[model samples]
Target: MSKPSGKSMDEIVALCRRRGFIFQSSEIYGGINGFWDYGPLGTELKRNLKNAWWEDVVLREMVGPDGKTIEMVGLDSTIIMHPKVWEASGHVAGFNDPMVGCKTEGCKRLFRADKVFMVDLGLDPSGKHVDVGVEADSKAKAEELAIGIAKRFKIRHDANPNPIAFSVLEEFAEIPTDMQRFPCPNCQHRTLTPPRPFNLMFESHSGPIQSDDNKVYLRPETAQGIFVNFLNVVNTTRVGVPFGIAQQGKAFRNEVTPRNFTFRSREFEQMEIEFFIHPSTAKEWYAFWRDNRFAWWQSVGLTSANLQLREHEKDELAHYAKEGAGTSDIEYRFPFTAPGFGELEGVAHRSDYDLRQHAEHSGLRDKMKYFDQERNEKYFPHVIEPSAGADRGTLALICEAYTPDPSRPSGVYMKFHPRMAPVKAAVFPLVNKEGMPEVAEKLYRELRKKWVVDYDPKQSIGKRYARMDEAGTPYCLTIDGQTLKDNTVTVRYRDTLQQERIGIDRVGEFLGQKIGSAQV
Candidate 1:
């Protein structure tokens, strides 16, 4: 299927508001940056997205090698864990974004250094297009990307020398600079200060003691919690190597700047899985999870053309994705993201770094090893993590599903897969009278018990169907005089606009068959 052209963030935000999908958090108090609240429709879609993920990753067993199947277990860990846990996982020190603040008076907004460089180059603030160093560590690679961007954008040291754009960009890439300054992208003034490290974790005090000694942190990623409980899960579930622990929960990040609506929120939900496997099989399992996740997104209705796998360059691999553990991202063509694409999820081979970290830090190294009865080997299982943002996933779906139908004036409808649609179907009485309402109401009530159904009796059947279409309802059932005569009704499919007549008694069966288990 051909993918729809990019939809502006403004247009999407407007639709979300008009349709009650999402809203600004605390909007009455001028709203909060990097925070948002999902409305009725948005909440339903997000919930359904996570539920679908759980069903696929944990509940449903998948065929494995030699026709064997792997069944995953689910996990729900606490949001705030031990402070030492952060120290072990590396979030306490390294989970940061280089921040460069505008030094110009009256404008002191901090910008992520790479994003600033992107804007300086007359492009989207996402740096997905400019590949600086694939094999370099984060800071060094950022610096390299800055230099390449400087040269490409022709940010001449002589022409815009005083702009200090290149200098500021380079400095921020490596370290927060207190020495050099640059022009502010927003103010166009030379009020940019040297970059500084801003830790993303949200820290809090424990036991009413506001001191570092009593500090705890809201998790920035869901992976650590799973790692921390690896032993517990094994002991309790009797699951061994090659199993997964899937979780969906809220994570917090003190983002430098939250732009593009809910794409970069400070508080967001994540659906992640930490799949454990024998160390020797890390790469193989990595590829398996990578392709599996990519295919799963397509199965849920994202277009294949708009989705691509981006291998992490050797230089830019994650600190943990080392020594045979590889990493890659599934990128989607989000209109506002840089170069027209952004990461929807990441699949990483973490090389047992996390488990090793926890073992060493918690002083349980010897006891932390997993005993594989099948192989008679005791070892720390390497991990392949597939982590995605629930909110971002929904946004990607919304962007992909927003289709324009030229058959109607000002026509646009969400072409969601029935599985992801918030409202699955709508029931409309052909008219307000002639016993049609009686039959429609009965069908509506019955379908409501089975699906997220809606009933429309006020407007003409045509308008009602249109409204349901905009809401992404997959099927609309209309009851007219035919239903009173032969107990058959018209069923209109959303994407095709094709109609089929079936017995009223068989509507449930027809929908169940069309929707299928996953679609339902």
Candidate 2:
């Protein structure tokens, strides 16, 4: 029989749950939206991804255009910094998503209007698709498009006996504000409230006071925490200018609509690096970091064919980078949207804006610069930040690795890179008896000392192999009747399904060589 190809997002989600990779946050009591918990396999897959990013991208040394190599240091900053941190970073005023809700009595669902409209109009909402080139002009044309789309479209309404025709949807495309202006997407009634700035930061009261006196917000991005600690890292580590501070941690945003599984979530983790460089050197550094970041994503098993380098238009640039810096996004070909792609990471050139803002707001304005020891002059360092979401990265890896199970056309498997597989190796016995179980168990125990190995003596060898493939186990070692006569086991490869005989004593070394390392 012929093998299958790729899988759908819905299929991936189902497989994740079935294989103990991910689960909804509180299944018993009606689970929360925009939040999910990583199960055992999901956790390993995520951990390996984060470690790979850190090892290959963040912590590595890089040479600048001037041929000077710079080293990067890692930081684990607080999830909640000083309340003024938000004000300094512009998160308080700028970190907002436009939200519109249905005015229907019971189906009052809120959604990110731009995203929904793109989907409704058969447009892909990725940074590389709906948000680039012509998308640069979309800010001025969204209302026009919504108007055009509505002229011929009719949708059901809560009050009207029939669907509303040519309903007004201006509110959905209008600029961000605190007004209700569009029709409810659910009920065709012109019941959508005005577009409002929904600040995404999760807020809380610090200390004993529960008032504005101690108001603070959970860190919405990991970069700010790294920005504020520039002085500490430079001083303690003896790091010089043009260096970077990397961080990976949890961030919070009360998303209006957190659809697409873990791709967008209210509580998520971020892996970010704020690379400091001279203002005159920002362009070179930007290109360098951008290319390196792009390559790293591909190295993590995302196919190059499906990745895109989406440069930000002048209009798409963030407020801090618009004046003097460049910005772009690395988008991936996801399966959910029509275009099958979306933004996975953002690479931006943020001039001294961040450090400048932090200094002025935190009473450290003069303290955020670096001294050129050779020139004996001090200047505020511009930054080229490559920021990525951990959840999205994990999802992208899952998407890239997922394939249909060949044995069962309807079933699926993960063709994860050897280094990226959750369980490194799976051990199985051809049959439950015939001393096969003892050999498989012995090999499994020995391999577990060096790798995350799975042991199974139940079911037929074919079924066990199918389960291992689904879980993305790169190698499957089967101890069969032949193993009783000789100390060799049949090692089946997950990606190719090729089998070869290897001595039981050499299984560890065999896998270590195939996977590049023991994985321990």
Candidate 3:
């Protein structure tokens, strides 16, 4: 309302902080970069999203096309594991970003050269920078010319005669030596050294004194924890292949540059499910999850025109992935892309990569064996992972639901689906007098049994209605003099702003149908 002060992304972040949805981590000490803490409303909203995910992929897998349903079990995994786990997973060796630090005056900014170049030129780093043209054209010449300009002007790692752990992009391009930096790229005041790799994992000691054997790492992804414990669940629960292990947990990533608010964070929560299927069935399930995740966004009321599926290029797959896909592929159809089309979720086909790595390093990997006596098949199960960021989804939901009332320019409210709204309904007393307060209190207490309801008696009935509307409470109930005599109350709808008098006893039933029927 009031045209909302900052830009969309800025407004969302400000609203979140003001409403106690989230806060910067360690704010008292100037805050830690790339980490955040969820306050009251933020916690509730996050839990709502997690609850929604659990209800679908975990508690109920939903009905299949054949009209049959599947029940899936859930897993709560550890936040840290053995250090060797990272080594075998290829994280210790390959989990890195090519960084070049600048000592330009007081500006000691370390950056991903690849990203900064595109950012400076106002281009999508994920697009043409990595693509070669379809055929011989001026595009190739332009790209080559652009590369030459970038190497000389752009801040990058210095040149070297010996091999560096990770080579700079221009080095492999056979650019002229004059373009390479012999001294620090930022200052050009000191002789430069070759670029080196930096491990991204956060390490910790098991006991008092740190030692080699006691070394452990904070998990970079939730999927690995599930994969490491797959055998335990399979053997103990006696669940065969084709089952999944769903987990919601915290993960840490030491990013080189964490910008665009919480879009890229050092610490965040993730909702991941490793659906195990036969290797032959992995592709089929991958497609199935791609659609399922897409539908999930829609169910939360996201416009389909705002989302699309994109298959990864052959060179883009990770060492463990055979087939990988992203959820936000199409360009911005929806207004909020301040940081540009943020990835809401992804599904990747990881073919026994995790289990095989753990088995090779830890000597504990057992190939998942499934027997179909009639079909006579047994093999290690391939996995399709539907990984999503809880924060990203939470933020996207806010953006999607945020609406400015055209009729009432000063009024703003979230049009959240009932299942996702933090407060489903608000109960108010028409006046804080006579027996109205007591009657409204009774209704509020009763309604809380079935929904998340708030009681507001500090302001006028009109003021209370506006407050609830701003909080995205879909339904509001007010007890008036009529309620004391006839046991009837006014039920106000948030979206339509229509009020209907209903028997007090039937308010619970009436609201339940409306709230429950709303999509997630």
Candidate 4:
């Protein structure tokens, strides 16, 4: 079954901007494409998400398929590394996307070749039905093509025999040599250039002199850092084979088209695990990680039908996983891709390719082998990697939490999981007098030491509850008139809008029960 987010991308983006969740980078200067800035709320939400992942994967005690405890360690690698690192990882030579450019005068624009589709506009001229094709890279662009054609032909919007009736002709794997037949999406003219390779890595100079010798590139992934340091980890730690190295850090990629908010940004964060295991047990470990990672996402509040697990096809395998058991993806059905899913995470069986490549390139082939004491043999251990995008996962959580209702003043409330909510609880005074403020402030001070709690006594009780609901605060403790007499407070629940009076001393225990401990 497929679950569609009743919300639209426009609504989600608007909420992000209005509620201080996210903002476009350099927005005052018309903003830069493929970049974004997270606001205070967004930063807290992302930090909580990353912390949850780290605690679950690295700090928590995990069991392997053999019923033994798994060993996992953490690493923080630099964003800029030795230039030779990219050479060994195949990013320097093979990380290229097929690109095509529109040559229309004063309107040049580039697009990924495979993403450009040719659509038949079905324009009839002189009683003969003629197929007029236009190029577009998205559904919005296709709608623009239809409107442009309607205006050019002086056809009314309500006319029968619509001139804009059309369907996709084909997607261009590569623009043909005779590219004049295809029209430009912007200029609506036959001016698209042939396809060519465009590298996605960002380049820079490492020294004072700007020359080829001092040139460097940003690390495109965090996995290579783990692979290059595998020997150091094995030597310094007590972990044997069947161990894993986990990392969470920033990664860079100059995406040609960074659309769908932060989904395809040029800069992002990744939570990746590279598990080293015996070559003979690669299949079992691969299946275990695939299922384990899927369940982890569900445990963190992705319990809707929008989440799914899909196995990769033969052609979909990455360069390193071709000789292994294959790759599986945990995908989410976002608002933009409703009824169709987008990749949230991937669990791949990367057969000793990384270690082998790094060892061969660094001339440490003999030292890179792992000695199995049980089998009394030395060999390169196979890898099972579970890579997840921090930014993408945070966005999915936000998309899943957005709930609209006509009965409330704010019309919508964020239904974030108690463990994942930015503000765990809010304390409000029914009115700003009669010792209620003192009581609420004391409670706020105490709770803030344990979890993120808000204190808002400047507004009406209903308004305060509305604000906290929008912020996804699970519980709200209100010090009402009865608090001073009986020493009890009203606890308002965000999801059901139900309230019940409870002892003032039990507030801490109440929050602890609803949400988890403050450690994560």
Candidate 5:
């Protein structure tokens, strides 16, 4: 099928709010800066996405690289851990971002140094484009600045009248210290300060006494929790090397700027797997996961055109992954990063760095090693980590499923996969009279027992279908006058709009066949 032209972020955000998908946090109190709350539909959609991941990664058995069944296990870890855990994991000392603050009198906005870009404003006295720099936090903001400058100066170019093209001159960090004074993004003055290292972790006191002794931090990633419990899992379960520990939980990062809706939220959830393997098999396992994860996203409905798997370069490798095979990222072309792409998930080969660190810091060096009875040797197992952002995946799904069609009653409909749709099927009565409501209500109650179904007795049949379309409901079953005699109802497919007559008693089987095992 041909892909539809991309939709703007504004359109997607408006649909989300109108359909009760997502909402700003604490809107009554003017809202928080870097947080969001998922509404009923959004909550169900997210839950379905996470459940699908858990089922596919942990519960289902798959063939390994050696053509044998691989073992997988699940874990649920706490959000807060011992402070030393962070120290061992290198987060306490080095989990920082280069931050710069605007020194303008009325605007003291903070920004990540690398995120700040310098763009050409094309404002020159001689009617020629100059290289004078204007700073902005993102490419979108940079384009906005270009338009604002053009309007302010009333400069029009005959060759290209639509605001001369602008490109990022350089990053804030690349500028020399002597010439670091750039215009602030907010106030548009040369009052920005030099970049400094700022920790991204959120800190709090564990007890009533607010002191350094009881200082604690919210976890910044879910991978560490799996690492800390490596030995416990090995000892408790009958699994050996070449197994994985999967986890899904909340993680917090105090981002300097969270502008891309839920894409860069300060608080979010993650689906991570720390797959342990023999040192000799690190390369093979890394390749397996990189290919496997890329396919998994496509199976869940992300199109191949918008999804890509990119291998990291030497300079881009993380500290722990430097000695390993390498790391690969699965990127999605979000509306904000349309021409380009943003990171959706990363598959990295961590060469026993986490296990070694936790072992040394916790004074359990021997306990952290895995015993290989076949080889009669014990050592720290190498890990292949597949870490994905749950919120980012949810956002990607919403963006991909949005389809605009003027032929439909609703201008736009969410073309979600049957397994991923928030509402599996919606039930409606053809009319209010002739006992159609009774039949529709009974069908709705029966389907709701096993799936998330909707029943609407009000409004016209066309309007009900439109509402379901916006909600991303895959199938709509309507009871007409013929149903009272024939015991059959019309099942209207959401995507094709084709209808088929099926017995009312066989509705559950029809949904089960269409939705697969996603049903309750």
Candidate 6:
């Protein structure tokens, strides 16, 4: 299962476009910057990951020794909520990226220096390598130097001879500057600006009236929705303090710079859980959630070697959390892709900050309550939030599944686990004629109900299998002359290329057992 070497970030992006995994959004009009559209194969893979996450965290009903499973529930909420909510959540004033603008001659482009470095290195700008605290007093000088280097490397444009090189305009264009600005972490120049807040939330008008009172924001994270709706569900269901409300939904952030394909898009899906616990037990529950989430990722086929656990230092802890722990470093395969561990998931023990915020802002203090068996023990329940980026999870699965079988000439085959593969089993006809197509089509229809199946009769059997392999189909079923003779078909495994003759009538049962409720 060796990975393909010497592949650059551009090469992977081109391959994704060629193989129908992803496409630049609105390409006809030169495409929108920082946006992407998932193609058939990519969409399937993303969907499978989402479904798998729901099954693992939401519906599992996992129980611990403390009998806390009874308090968990799943919830869905709106993307936009009351404008005051963001204000109370600290997003209105504190959510922001430190952006440094290049005030150079004929070039004022705001360079997310962090992103610029990543782009140069073919890396993901996931806050691993770029530092934004650099004092850019010589902004003009830095822009000149950077533009000259970009030209020398000829890295500004796609390799289409369109000369998309970095150009200067009298008016500086605003680019995302989300990197850490050290007086110069890279050069150690020691001139640093005090960190300031850059709100990432997208604000909008809630009603036709464009007034200050109507200002609302698209949620920056899905966890807030669950938090806001906490009392409603708890009071209605009469659930206890240890219960949780899990959610999977879209959140919008005005990311200073959206790069690394869809990894840090302005809009993305999040799988989050707000586990309520006694204030006294918040730290323990935080640790518990952290371990559980880390284990879940490993169970889903992300190799343990490629992941790490990073604990947030005291100073780095968020304003609300008493403590927090992060997942270990993730090694992705893009250039400039940072080598350090970033937080893939985090479990933060927030001591009722959210509940207090909502209560004070909305004057609903009495509505939210918790009564424990400690008779007189009564207070707002603390929360341990386990949150992860859905896109990152999918990318990790792809990275883990990415394999190049030495036996195959095509170089690489994504060896996705049975549950994660986009297509579980590709149904193909041995040939385009002799009623084989009819049989394959019938089989495809039947299997499509139970699996994400594909039927391809245009290519030879070997070629078809290769195509499926690239798409990460776990198995391929072929209908040949032997099938008409014995009511049997060849079930070929993608990774091993081993074929087995199995009765056609029993195909579903065989696959169900083989894939049986695996975590993937």
Error of 2 at 256 (Å): 1.7
Once model 2 is optimally superposed onto the true structure by TM-score, how far is the C-alpha of residue 391 displaced, in angstroms? Answer: 0.8
Q: How close is candidate 5 to the true structure, as a TM-score?
A: 0.82
**Candidate models: Cα lDDT each:** 0.78, 0.76, 0.67, 0.84, 0.85, 0.68
User: Alpha-carbon error at 181 in model 3, in Å?
Assistant: 7.2
lDDT of residue 456 for candidate 3: 88
Ten-residue region with minimum lDDT total, candidate 2: 127-136
Residue 196 displacement (Å), model 5: 5.0
Better of 1 and 2 by lDDT: 1
For this target, which candidate reaches the highest lDDT against the unseen true structure? 5
lDDT, candidate 6, equals 0.68
Q: Which ten contiguous residues of candidate 4 have the minimum total lDDT? A: 162-171
Provide the global lDDT of candidate 3 against the true structure: 0.67
Candidate 2 C-alpha error for residue 304, in Å = 4.5
The ten-residue window of minimal lDDT in model 3 covers: 129-138
Could you give candidate 1's per-residue lDDT for residues 122-156 as a string of tens digits?
A: 33244232222111234444445554555654444
Candidate 6, residue 232: how far the Cα is off, in Å: 0.1
In the range 1-520, model 3's lDDT, one tens digit per residue, is 1222223666667777876778999999999899888887677777888888888777754764224464468888888887777888888866654555554566465544322221122233333312111111233333344334435555332232121121233442244242234223244333222344455777788899889879888988888888778778877885666778899999888877787677779888899988887776665677777878777777766664556566667666766773433222212222445333667677788887777777778875445444544457755678888888888787667777667675743266677787778888888888888988888999899988877889987776777777776667788888888888899989888888899999999988887777663332
Across 133-251, the per-residue lDDT of candidate 6 in tens digits comes to 12222444344354344345443422222111121111122322322232232333323222333567877887899988887889999988987898788778867777788899988
Count of clashing pairs, candidate 1:
12
- Put down candidate 4 lDDT per residue, 353-376, tens digits, no spaces: 989998999999878999989889
Q: Give the clashing residue pairs of candidate 2, or none.
A: 171-181, 171-182, 179-194, 180-193, 180-194, 181-193, 181-194
Residue pairs clashing in model 3 are 337-340
TM-score of each: 0.83, 0.80, 0.79, 0.83, 0.82, 0.78
Better-scoring candidate (lDDT), 2 or 5 = 5
